[model samples]
Target chain A: METGTAAHDDAAREPVWTGLPPGLLKMRRLLLVVWLGLLTVVLGALLNLFAGPAWAAFALLPLALIVWGWVLLGRNWRSWRYAERADDLLISRGVLWHHETIVPYGRMQLVEVTSGPVERHFGLASVQLHTAAAATDATIPGLVPAEAERLRDRLTELGEARSAGL
Target chain B: MTTPGAEKDVPEAAEVVREQVPVVERRLHPVTPLRRAWAPVAVIIGWAVHDPNQAQEQLTRLTTITLLIGLAVFVPAAGLYGFLTWWFTHFSVTDTELRIRTGLLFRRTAHIRLERIQAVDVTQPLLARVAGVAKLKLDVVGTDKKDELAFLGEGEARALRAELLARAAGFAPETVHDVGEAPSQQLLHVPAGVLAVSLVLTGATWGSLAAALVVPPLLWLATHSVWTVLATALPLLGAAGASSVGRFVGEYDWTLGESPDGLRIDHGLLDRTHETVPPGRVQTVRIVEPLLWRRRGWVRVELDVAGSSNSVLVPVAPREIAESVVARVLPGVTVPPLPALSRPPRRAHWCVPLWWRGYGLAVTDTVFAARHGLLRRSLALVPHAKVQSVRLKQGPWERFWRLAEVHVDTGANGTVTARLRDAEEAAELLREQAERSRTGRRDARPDRWMA
Candidate 1:
């Protein structure tokens, strides 16, 4: 009931493609999680040696966290999608519960395209859109660098036309 | 429903009188002299009253000290007052605009277009009341600072409000009407029951009685003297109680009236204040019903204006009355139905089950009883917007679980928040909401003009 009949009218709306390209390297960013986990476990063991029993319990928390990260990596590897609409863009992800976010071109306050050192090696970039209200902003990570730049230019053009009362 | 044509009873052009131009009359603030002298005088008096046994020996020393302090205070007060009196006397108003020049050490001049004026507020302190002068504050939309013209005759305040209102209505020549006619409607006065309840809640009444009866006896028992703590403490308590009573008595006859120009609020005890706020300047309207007032169905209405936020137009009225006033003042904004008191979400309620999958992180909450303010049981939702920047947090134990915590930073003063919870359905919900908000349309609706 939440979705209107117009939602099913795919021809009237823009084309939506599920899943990111294989070349996108979002999986490499998972290393940051591994580095943080190693630091916590080392620090926890050091504290357990110096302090008493309470410190040992605190140190064991990081070991338990690494297992949680592995589960998320397995789930996200199967369930992420990116779609482009006529007036807006959407990024949908989630294995069990699905979530779809739409970002209209007109309301985009700022669009930033960034490439990290690791991402540059892989020729991938991330796009973030900022809005006046803190809520409802969007970020799409791991796209081909050239594609990211093209999307940014298109969004800027649409934003200017909307502000002029078009 | 009446047709638009039937409702249109336009008056003849000749009969419509033009609005009078507002004239700015300024004078020095009467309280400046008293405020400057109060500190020095209090210091001298305390010195003189101390050590009665050494009074004779320290007479010369005390006199020298008092004179030095008095001169230090008197010189600045005299210089400032002289400069203010000269600078403030030069305000003027034409048919189109108002201009004022004021300052002592740093000279400053300000100009405000009549068309952009949103509201005019007149405030009078205790000294101003005796001197028959009040401070006028004019608010304009989109401006950071308000135009202030301090110290004007009480009659001038009313005249200025009338002139400004008339100008806003676009009055024309060729028609003359009496300035004082029967007011279109009566002002709504604060109810007696609410006032009585407010007094009881203040706790000043009980404290006053306790000080008068119990303190003297307690002093007599402790130090074998009636005049020890009782003499000092009782008088201070009485003075504070009396002032509280005075304020209540002063605000007893508060009333707000709807006039052709805008909303006119008149209230005061020792120093009466008259305020006029036009419709256009209101940025946001908030209607609050504190948990305590739910049974009485009373609500407090506050309007966020451009210049003034503290001096909120607080109209304590019934819930329905508050809603209607808001609808009239701010059109187009949706007014959600009044939430029932009993139906508020409890811990682990039904909505939790549907949304729990999205909540990837463990949520810890601390609940306390609602205080006396408008909102009760505060709920902080750390969504994607709050994520100032996101960071992946992991612990040693989490490495085994293969789970990472997504820390989202929500910026201050905006709905964006930093959420530090386990990555689950909650994190997904936040990301989706943030994406949707980024594309939502910005608010640019035009405000309603009184004319």
Candidate 2:
């Protein structure tokens, strides 16, 4: 057959898109403010000591950038969402530039759930799906620990069920 | 190639019979140790020939008697080590899998399932060829490291390769004995003169040669110095020349042939290699036509197979020959012609000002094709069944132009990112490609390839 109708495009059958937990947003924003705030305060004090309070006002520039980045991160987080389908996984994200990757369940080689020291502190984890091709950049970030493990297990199970040879 | 009627009718029974055969463990040829030892010695002799006087002075400095004694002891020690390694390494083929046991102190066993084997390659280095032995490399699925059987008798290697392929294809063990050499018909042979000319005519060679010739003279004029010309230009010229010479020697006597087992490519002057690429295993095929070669209507064809990357199907051939070879390699697939390709919108030129017109995408029933590049134009065709994933990307500039790129990714070689399509069209292509991939996979040949 040269062409066929989209079998899985029905709106009723489409799965709900899952967005990252708001706790991740709070943790990330807190981290940004703490790091940038420390830098700005220290740099401003140094400038006040060496170059006067007038030069200390220059430190406000970084503070302004931090504020802008804080808002940008929220938008990027909102843009990041994933939806599991009958045979493939869809990950759509990006603010200025949009990217939507569809990795078939049959192609998944490994599914991993990882939590770094900071993420562990924040009680947040990320799920990564790897395929034979590196171009399938499928990573769902900032999920609750339980949700990440659940997703990993479910994906691993589905991957084994539909596993196809390369 | 005997396709026995019994096996064809009853694949299940054939599998049962195939699994019952157990081959005994076999060591490499006895000459393997000597060949391995001689390989390094040959390299040393070649190096010593370059600076014989320095070698002589170094020998004299060491005292000839002592040097002779050291060589006498060292040669035997290396030989013993090689012998030990050879003795420990053994390979056996079972009905279900091929097992290679290697290592001296710590034991290691590599088990490659018969059905998971993508290809079997036979390669012979100069020393191996001289010793009438060849190395067998098994390209197994799901493994980045290749399993190699080093230094088997040339004929035995071929026989073993054929036997393995036959079993992998689901033939009954009995019928496999009838498949001797698997008679292949020669499709094309590249002449030495043509290969040499093609190498010299490439844009890279021309640019490098121009640099070597012009840079030295320009420096001599600007600095009024002969030392600068000698110091900089000679090495650049030699390095540039060496690459072309190496390719020429490596790709000498290039031959493309077709056999029941797969498409066979035999090449190399010093280290001969015989590569078999099954049509089903090819992930993508790229046909490249450089600007210089366009007038001659010649193009280079390359295939990205499942386990191996960037395997050259033909060094250079007529466009028709390339097209036919590609069609042969990818059976039942039709590559859309260049003129029928869908080009990007004219206003999308803002992103790629010079080459926007060159970018094109074509989606056929079985293949997703992308055409791009101004100087070295290329058309890459990926069979939908071989597609691993689909991605749609739109950058800020592309967003400004309402353009997006649809990337069709294959297993290993690279992604085909067709850029500067309308945003909606790009999304549609991504969906269509993913859908096609699913359907293609369903209709593809089974993992038991021969069956």
- Whole-model Cα lDDT of every candidate shown, in order: 0.52, 0.83
C-alpha positional error of residue B23 in candidate 1 after TM-score superposition, expressed in Å: 12
- Candidate with best DockQ: 2
| Worst 10-residue lDDT window, candidate 2 chain A | A1-10
TM-score per model over all chains:
0.50, 0.88
lDDT of 2 by residue, B1-451 (tens): 2335456568797666555545689998788787656655777788898898898877778977898898999899778877887898899887668899987688888988988776778999997888899988888655544368888999999999888887787776566777666789988898999888888778787677778888998898899888788988988798678668777887899999998778899999999999886548888889999888888888999888767633798998888877888888888877688889989999887888989988898888889999999789899999888888899999888999899999988886479889899999988787778778876888787766778
- DockQ, all candidates in order: 0.08, 0.70
Give candidate 1 misplaced runs (Cα > 4 Å). A1-166, B1-101, B107-118, B140-147, B163-184, B191-194, B197-250, B280-306, B310-451
List where candidate 2 sits over 4 angstroms from the true fold: A1-9, A12-15, B1-23, B38-66, B141-146, B215-235
lDDT of 1 by residue, B346-367 (tens): 2222333433222222221210
The i-RMS of candidate 2 is 1.1
Model 2 TM-score (2 dp): 0.88
True contacts kept of 2: 0.69
TM, chain A, every candidate: 0.61, 0.91
Top lDDT hit: 2
